[model samples]
Target: MDTYKNVVRILDEVLSLEGRSASFSRDTALLGAIAELDSMAVVSLITALEEQLGISIGDDEIDGDTFATVGALVDFVDAKLKD
Candidate 1:
């Protein structure tokens, strides 16, 4: 499975982006840059990602840096899947 694409799809669904997230590149900023990505959204996103991808994410594993960019988020998800 393609982790990057799956991550993007989940982001779009969780954030209610309506396909806007489809254009996000690796460099595209997320947390602070996106208006829809508030703290609650982050939690919802984490839940959605965990449920959809079959990965478990501990609270300590998350931080602003994890959602800094599209690529960073994908990398975080990839790493979580490995464990």
Candidate 2:
């Protein structure tokens, strides 16, 4: 499966973006740049990613940088999957 595509789908669902997330590229900014990606949405996105990707994310493994962009989030998930 395409990790980036999956991540985008999860983001769309969790953030209720109504498919708007489909247009996001690797450079697409998230977090502060995106009004929908507040604290609550971050938690929801994490939960959705964990459940959908069947990966466990430790509390300490995440930081602001992880959600800084679409590429960053996908890289974070890919790294977690490698472990």
lDDT of 1 by residue, 1-83 (tens): 89999999999999999999879999999989999999999999999999999999999988999999999999999998888
lDDT of 1 at 54: 99
How much is the lDDT of residue 52 in candidate 2? Answer: 93
Against the true structure, candidate 2 reaches a TM-score of 0.96
lDDT at 4 for candidate 2? 94
Which 10 consecutive positions of candidate 1 have the poorest summed lDDT?
74-83
Backbone clashes, each candidate: 0, 0
RMSD values for the candidates in order, in angstroms, are 0.5, 0.7
Candidate 1: residue 40 lDDT (0-100):
96
Report how far residue 35 has shifted in candidate 2, in Å: 0.8
Residue-by-residue lDDT tens digits, candidate 2, 1-83: 78999999999888889989978999999989999999999988999999999999989999999999999999999998888
